[model samples]
Target: MSDTTNHQRIIALEAENAALKARIASLEARLQLNSAPPQSLTHTTPTATPELSAEEYLRYGRQLIMPQIGLPGQLRLKNTRVLIIGIGGLGCPAASYLSSAGVGTLGLLDHDLVELSNLHRQILHTLAYIGRPKVLSAIDRLRAANPNVTYIPHITALDKENALEIIQNYDLVLDCTDHPRVRYLVSDAAVIAGKTVVSASALKTEGQLVVVNKPTSSEEGGRGPCYRCYWPRPPPTESVVSCGEGGVLGPVVGVMGVLQALEAVKIISSGALEGQRAPASANEAAAGSPGTEGPSKPEPASMLFFSSYSPTPFKTLRMKGRRADCISCGTPSDPALKITASTIPDYDNFCGPGPDAVLLDPKDRRTVMEVGEMIGRENVVVVDTRDETQFGITSVGGSRNVPFVLWQRGGKVPEEFWRAVEEEGNSADPQEEGEKGKGTKGKEVVILCRRGNDSQEAAKMVMEDPRARDWKVTDVVGGIGEWARKVGGVVEY
Candidate 1:
């Protein structure tokens, strides 16, 4: 066949596929409407057998054939409801898998709007959803993937006031949020509501996953530990790094999100849903014989760590059982530790405010415009403190790259920086001291980074150096980001 003919055939097949999906969605919607009990019927008798349409069985046929997830497991999955707390990188892929796997209902909760930056890691969001709410964006894509599943969008941040109420509606919760405060809030709320939580986080090339508050039989060492059980208190605020600030690989987060969905599926299929047991047929399939035991129970809780750069990229750390004195899940000896809807502790106060970016005073800072005007001037040195990779992307015309990492841990300032300053200072004429004294007597060292935060610290470090006493040292007020916003030439990323 000719290349053009093949291309045309491919497009026609895609159109046909889309039409079929629309028809399936319409049929499913009509089935649900027809099956729903009328409002006039205040109460109705429950059916002995749960309903699973022929379309559903065909949709999940591959997984249904697996002994681990036989007919009984499919029914359990069809009855499960899961709530994902964030619709960003982790939530996007996790929600995609769970909904496609036949989870009956999924609650997507997020207050953030879709952005150009989120497209790389957040798989469900597309360019068309750029400024739309993330939950709405996720719902549109997820519904198309599986029209039989129900999707609920909560276009608001999960706060103390509504955390428990919202979480109580779902059978399981996924803590895919980025912030520590919100993570604590979600874990606490899930524990308080007696719901299992699958939590995961990724930053840079590393990712972490753990199943917290997993339901267990009394013989299986009681219930798994809650989030607070592992960490009695939150980590220091300064140590926390957001994906926006520290940077994260797209696939790294996607891996963690997909794993979270897998864990949720395993937990649900293992008959952890409200102590409901799998049917005898499922037990027989799992046991490889009729009249045998039911499906095996969930594995003990353990934290999973993955580092793409490591030779052994995956490691499982066995987490200790629940801490006896855990404030969130421990004995209610202390009423303050017990979290209620009205008594949920202020997480911001508990975790402390995020790292402050403003450390230097007004005199030590220069606006991006001031720095822009001094770009190529004689005896004016612009030092970029971002990592070498970022500096290579795009930088000021005459700026010298001196990464901020070199200044950390009592490390000495790079000699190349001093050499650049000396070379620029040598070009200045002593006779130019009258009106151009700014960079004549000594070089003016202006530091900058992607954001103003690091530049402020870099400037403070430079100013404290005795060698910089004779030179005018200052940082850009908002770093390169400000330059991109105010001045037109520079690229922000």
Candidate 2:
């Protein structure tokens, strides 16, 4: 062959080699993904005796050696099934530990998809799985961590219709969700299904945990108190804050999640299941009769509070056992409190409606487009009601910072804010303004915040104040987030 022909062949061969490498990489990734537990293991039938493989023995050897969780406890873990709801911050660590400890079956249930914001605290999900269902992402990580364990993914929210049916299959349920309605729903469903629940929540450097509806003999006060026994009514919608709104430290939530796993593992190995007994010292075993129960005692109903900033980070509040008057767990003569699938109360109604963005009349609310026009106009005064930190992050130019918290505390707008408004009103060019520049009527006060809800509240407060009777008070319809999307000037965060 000629030299030119040989050079052309060399280039073609190099291109072919690159294509083959890419194909090999793709196949390897597929094999790794498919190497997870078989389809049969997804719904493994529990046998009377669950035997562990040699690989599992080595995998869980560290935890198995502990006297608290020896051979018997390991087998109990092999047979126990746990369902974790809301695979976000708390669920991520809790599931990781449980699967690593060799729990036979884990049910991962979540309705949300993985977002970029969830990665800091939701440890199981990564950048690769963003926009995917959280449960599927969690399953991928969990299966890789412990292939011996069975993982069942429920890629849907737990509602009254399906909560009981799904919860019935698991020995225990973890209420890792952040919302109040879901918490109540989980507790009610767990109570109805006769399952124990380890519920936990974390936000803003603080976390709270509780194990409720623990299965007990008739003598043990007919099972511990359900969540309703402690708080029958949900907190006011305004009082409840989410992680997105209030913010949370990543480690604070991770700590709460790890503790939840610890509680779950303890519950499983505590002789609560058939053919399993809490391990005892040799002396105690020798002293007791053959039929005598082991030293396992029911953990008293209690709430554990953790604050990362506090010197005493952990505090336990002992709670009363089940109440006779509890609407859900009670023996009230009224039958309406009892919740079944068909009788489950509408949680949205029970919790009350969420914040109303349209609380004010149309005339009193201005859209972001209108606000964009008003920016830098001396006659229009924009007051940002978000906190100082948020105000510093990104804000409309010439807008005054008057946080909503001041209004929430029943305080009037500060003198500085009025001074700024007065300066803006005085600086208006009468000749340039025309008819609108007549008297204080020319000045307009526009309220804005992170979201429109707080601005509406603040606008109402400002309107009610006697000081600004002549001024036009209105709030931006969708606040900074809307402005960021529509106008592209301010940062939404």
Which candidate leads in TM-score? Answer: 2
Task: Please provide the root mean square deviation of candidate 2 (C-alpha atoms, Å).
Answer: 11.0
| Tens-place lDDT digits, model 2, residues 1-493 | 9987885575455445534543464455335434433222222223322255667767888987898887667766865779999999999999999999988778889888788989989999999878667887787788787877767777678887899999987888999998888999999888777788999999999999998887655324447788888888888766677787778999999999999999998878765543223222343233232221242465677899999999999999988888887777777678776776677677878786664436788999999998898787656889898888888999998888887777666556666566656656666653433333244464789999877988887788778877788889999987898999999878766
What's the lDDT of the predicted structure labeled candidate 2? 0.77
**Model 1: C-alpha RMSD to truth?**
9.7
Runs in model 1 lying further than 4 Å from the true structure: 1-50, 218-221, 275-299, 331-343, 355-364, 411-444, 460-473
Show pairs that collide, candidate 2.
none
Candidate 1: C-alpha lDDT: 0.77
What is the Cα-based lDDT of residue 439 in candidate 2?
43
Cα error of candidate 2 at position 28, Å = 25
lDDT of 1 at 8: 55
